[model samples]
Target: MGNSNDLRSKSLWMDIEVAPDARPLEGDQACDVIIAGSGIAGISTGYELALKGLAVMIVDRGRIAGGITARTTAHLAPLCDDLTSEMIKLRGEEISRAFYESQAAAVDRIEAVQKREAIDCDFRRLDGYLFQALNTDSKIIDDELDAVRKVGAPVHRLVGVPLAHCGNQHALRYPRQATFHPLKYLKGLAEIIEAKGGVFYSETIVREIEERKDGSVAAKTDSGVITAKAAVVATNSPIVDTLALHTKMAPYRTYAMAFAIKRGAIPDALYWDTLDPYHYVRLQPGEGAADTLIVGGADHKSGEADDADLRFEALEAWARNLIPAAKNVTHRWSGQVLDTIDYAGFIGRNPGSQNIYVHTGDSGQGMTHGVAGSLINSALILGDTAKWQEVYEPTRKTPSGIGNFVRENLTAVKNFAEYLAPGELKSLDDLKPGQGAVVRQGLSKIAAYRGKDGALHARSAACTHIGCHLHWNSFETCWDCPCHGSQFAVDGTALNAPAVSALADVKTGD
Candidate 1:
C-alpha cells in the first residue's frame, strides 16, 4: 500500500536469494495461531510459536520479508530515533528504560537463535552511535546522554572520532547494537519453523479476518481459509482491520541510496544525522554487483514530499562532503516507517477486539521492535502477561505523550487536508512544468504526468508486481509502490526490480 508508480522502477535492499512465490492456501487449515505478513516480525513470531509446539500458519501478501524489512536501511539501535530523553519524557522513565532493554534483549535473542540454529545472516554486534555533528554545542547531546544513562546502558563519549573540518565532535556510543541481512535472518528462521512443522505461505494474501462467537478467528485467503484461535497482524503496517492502530501510528516515508565503496568506508559502526530529515549511513560488505555505502533517511510522511531526486541529490552531496570518493549510486530506494504517537510501540489486542492483535509503530527501530513485537505478540496470545506488555499496550495512552500527540497529529491533519483541496490537476493545458495527477479512466486507474517541458503523459497506476495502489512520489518525480521495492520514472517506464513490466499508453487530453 505505497506509491507504486515510481516504486516499480528501482531494485532495492541488499538483494539475496530468498525465494517467495504466490501460493494458494489449500484446504481448511486449523492452527492455534495465524500470523499475517511474513517479514521479520511475522516470521519471528511464527518461529516462536512453532518452537512452543503450537500449530502455526505464517502468510504474506508478497514474498517473505519483502515489505518494509527489505526496504529498511537495517539499523538496529536502542537510541529510539528521537532522543531517548524525549522518550523518557513522552513515556515514563520506567517505560522508556523497558523500551531500551527490550531492544537490547531482542538483539540478544536474535544472536542466541542464530547461534543455536547456525543461521549465517551476517549478524554482527557493533556499537550503535547517537553522534552530534550538526548541532554539536546543542543540549540534545546532554539530554540524550542523560536518557542513555537513565536507561541503564553505559554509553561512552567518543572523544576521538577523527573528522576533517566536519564537526561531529561529540557522540554517545552504546555497545552491542547490531546489523544484519534482514531477509537472510527471516528466511533462515522460516526454514527452521517449517522443519519444526510450521507452515509458511508466500504470496498468500489474507484479504479478510473474521472473529467468530468463540473468539476463534478465520483468516480468509484467496485459495482457502485458515481457522486459528488467535491471529497476529504483523504485516509491516498491519493489513488486518485494527481499531485506532492506523491513527496511533503515522507512516513516515524515508529514502536510501547505495553508492559503490571500499570495504573500510566507515568501519562497521553505524551513523545517523541528528537533523530534521536525518540521514543514516552504513556499509554493505558484499551486497550488490559491487560493494556500496548505504545512506538512508530524508523522512517525510507517506504522501508528503513533492520531489525525491532532490533528496537523492542531497544525500549524494552529503556523502561527497563526508566521504569525497562516494559515487556510483547503484541502488536508490525508499521505505515507509510506522511511527507511534508515543515513543514505544503498540503490541497488544486491537482496543476492543479480543482475538485480534497488532505489532506496529516502531518509528525507525523496526528491526529490534519487530523482533520484540514477535516475542510480545506470542506472550500476549498465550495469555502470558509479561511486564513488557504493560509498556507496549496497543490501547494504552501516554499521559506524558499528550504534547507529542498534539504536535504530530496536528501535522497529520494538515497534510491529510491537501487531498481534499481543489485538484492540483488543472486539466492537460494547465498542468505544471513537471508534476503528476491520479485520473480515473472508466474502470481503469491512470497516473497522468507533465514532463519538464510541460508535455502530457499517462500510464497505469497499478504496480505491475502486485496490485497495491501507487502514490505520486513528488520527491522522486516517480511512482512508488508502498507494498514492495518498485519505482517508475515520470514517463511510466519501469526503473525498479520485481516488476519488469512497463506502463500502458497514456490517455492524453483527459
Candidate 2:
C-alpha cells in the first residue's frame, strides 16, 4: 500500500529547481504601481511598467509564478480558447476581429521580448492545428476557418493530421504560433524587472486593497501595508471585488497531465479539437530528461463536483487513445480558469475605482491575455492609449452575453442549495487518513480531515467568501467553495480567491 501521508498532487511544470527569489514585506513600502499577483499578468505588467521608469512592486501570497501561470499548458496559440466561431456568434464580427488581433499581437510581443532580452525559455514558433473529431460536424470547421480568416489569421484547411490515432480527418492549420516554458520565462522577466529597479516580494498575502480619497491605493497585507499611486489586481479571480467581477465570470477547474515520451514520438506542434470541453496538446522538449507531451482538458465548474481524479483519468484515457505511445503519466494538476460571459477578458480599470485596474476572466487564454492585458494596463497607466484599449474595457457591456451571464449566475445561485443538503459524512469516524469529509454536527456542517496519525482537524464548512457550503477535495487536500471557487488548505488557510480570508477553525468537541 502507498503511504497515506502522501497526497500526491502537484504541477509538472513547476518541477524545475532554480527560480527567482525575493524577501517578504517587512513594513510599509511604496511604489508607483503595486501589483497584487506575480503570475503572467502581474509580472508582464510589472516588467512593462518598470521599462517606462515606474517604480513598481509586485507581491504574491506564494512564490513568484507559483499561481495559475505555472499550471498553464504554455501554448501561445493565435486561436482563442473560447473559439473564434463562438466569438463571432457572441460578440459579432468587429469585436471578434479586435479580440483576435489582440491575442495575435500578444504572441508577437512574447516573441519580440524573447529576442530583445535574449531570454532562453525554449520559445519556439510552430504550426497549430484545430481539427474536428469523427463525430463532430464539418460545418464547425468551416465556421471557425471563416471567422479566423476574417481576423487575418494565417490559416488554411487541412485534410488530415500526420499523427497516429488523432481521430480527426479535417483540420485548420494556423502558422507561426508558439510555446515556451512559462516559469522560466517568468524568471527571466523577473530578473530584468529587478535590474530595472522593480521590487518583488513573495509570501506576502494582501488582505485587502483600499483606495484612498487622495488618489492613492494601499494594499493591506499580512506583513505590512503597500501604498502606491495605482494597483493592479491580476489574481485569476478578483479578491477585491465581491460582486461586480465575480458575477460576470464563472470559475472552472481544468485538469492537465504530462506524459513521458520518446523524442519525436509526437510532432512538435500544438493541437486542439472541437469537442465541447476541447482538448489542447503540445510537446515539450525535456532538455536532458525524457521528452514530455502535455495534454489538458476536462474542464468543469470549480467545487461543482468532487471528481478531480475522474477528470484526470478521462484525460489520460483520451491522450492514450490518440497517441498509443504516451503510456507513462508523469504528473497531474488542476488550475482554475475564470470564464468571461462576454468571450473576452476584463483588462482595464476596475469599476468605480479610478486608480485600480484588474486583469481577470482570461477564459483559458491566460498566457496571451495576461501579456496583452499588461501592455494595455501599462499604456493606460502611463497616460497613453492602446489600439485595443476599448476592446477589453472592464465596464463595457455586451448584450450578446446577457444570456450567458444570466445562466452562469443562476448556476451560482443554485449552488447555494448545497448548504441545505446532507453532509458527505455522518461522522468524523468516516474520514480516512489523508482524506477530508464534510460532516453535519448539530445543524452546522464541519469540514473535517484526518491526519496521518488519525487526529481530526475541523473547520467551518461555510465558505469564507459567500456563505455557500464547502466541499472536501481529496485530490488537492483542500476545502473548496462551490459558489465562488474559494479554496482553503487542510489547515484552513485560504489558498485562492474570491475568498481572501481563511476558513474559521472549528472545535471538534465544542
Candidate 3:
C-alpha cells in the first residue's frame, strides 16, 4: 500500500485529454444569463437555455472539466449515495419518487445529448446492484428493496450476481443505469452550445455576484463585469450567499482509483455495498488500450484529517478482495463532495435574492444532480413550471436531517476552539521542506509552509470563510478549513469556494 502510485494526485479521466483554451473575459459583457461555473451543471444549463434562444455566457476559474467534474467516477445511476430508505424517511414517498424519477430523467437527458450531438463518449446502458457487504446485515438490503417498491422504481432482487466477489449475497438490481466518458460528453456539449451561439470563458474568476437596480444581476470578474437578466452560481458550492448554504451543507473528501483489467474481466454494471462508507465499482471498455476497473469509497470529513495514503491503501485492499483480476493501480484521485444536511440537492433561487440562482449540495451524486440542476434551474429562469422544482427547492428545510445538522454544526463549533489550542508545531525549526504547520506567535496563529526551494511562506491561520483555523493537508499540500472545507494553496491563495478571497499573507523570517 505504501508503494501506491503518486499519480493519485490527478484523476484517471484526465487520460482522455482535451485542449480548449477560450479567452478570458476582457471587458464588460451582458447576456440573458451569467453562469459562474464550467462543469456539467453550468454547461448543461447553458446548453438548455441556448436552445431556447437565450444569450448565455459561462465563466470558469480554470479549464473546462478541470475541477470536481473530472474527478467523478462518471456513474449515471438513479440510485443516490443516500439510501432510498433514508430518502423515504426524510422526504416522504412522493418527493422521494420524484427524486428517483428526476435522476432517471437526467440519465435520459445525457443519452439524448449523445444522440443529438453524435457524441462517441463510450456511452452504455447497464444494470446497477446494491448488495450487502460482508459485515452488513441482510435485513438492510431487504428494507431498501421494499422502499424501492414503495417508491415505484423498477428494481429486482438478484440471488446470483456475475461477480465472483459477492458469491451468494442477494443484491437489489436497477436496470437501465449508465456510464460514460464525462469529459468527452462535455466536449460534445460544449461544441453544440457554441454552435448555438453560447459563449464560454475559461480561466476567468468571478469575484462577486450581486443584484442591480431594474431587476438584473452582475457577476464581477477580474477583467470586467457580466450583467445579465439572471445569474447561476453553479460552482460546486455557491461563492455568493456564503453563510446560508455553507451552514446547511458540509464538505466530504472521497478517494477513488482506476486499475487496469482485461476487457470483459468484469460485468459492465454498477456495484455498491451497504457499509457505512461503502465502496462503489464500475467497469469501462479499454481491453487492448488498457481498460479500467474504477472503485471509490473511504469518505471522511474534509480538512478534518490528512489520511489520503491510508484511505488509498484501504481502497486498494478492498479492490483486491472483490476484483481478483485487478492489476497495478493506474490512476488514483480524491474528489470533494458537499453533503447536504438533507438527502436531496438544492437547485433553485438563492434565498433572499430575486435574480440569483444556485445549484449545489450534490450529496455525492454530482452527475445526476448536475443535470437535474440544469432541468430545474433553467425552467425557473425561463419562467416555465418544472415538475420536481419543490423537491429540490433551495429554501426547503429537512426536519429529519436536523439531528445530523446539529451534530455536524457542533463539530464546526468545536473547530473554532482551535484558536486556543496549542499550535501543531512548537516552532518553525521542526518544519521540513515542502511541509506546513500551524505555529503560535505571541497570541496569534500562523500557517507556515516551507517550499521545496527552502523558502518559508506564511499566512494567517484563520480561514477567511468563518475564521476557523486552517489545518495542513500533506496529501493535497493545502491549508484546509475543518469548518466548511475552504482550501488554500501553500502561498495562501484560495483554491476552492465558499471562500473567494485568499488568506492574508504573513511575513516569515528565516
Residues 12-116 of candidate 3 have per-residue lDDT tens digits of 777553337567889999999999988889988998999899999999876766678888998998865789998888878989888888999999999998987
lDDT of the candidates, in the order given: 0.71, 0.84, 0.85
Model 1, 382-414: lDDT tens digits are: 778655788789878777766656665565446
Kindly give the stretch of ten consecutive residues in candidate 3 with the minimal lDDT sum. 1-10
Error of 1 at 113 (Å): 1.1
Q: Estimate the lDDT of model 2.
A: 0.84
TM-score, candidate 2, is: 0.96
Ranking by TM-score: 3, 2, 1
- Model 1 TM-score on a 0 to 1 scale: 0.84
Off by over 4 Å in 2: 1-8, 17-19, 166-168, 288-290
CA RMSD of all predictions? 5.6, 2.6, 3.0
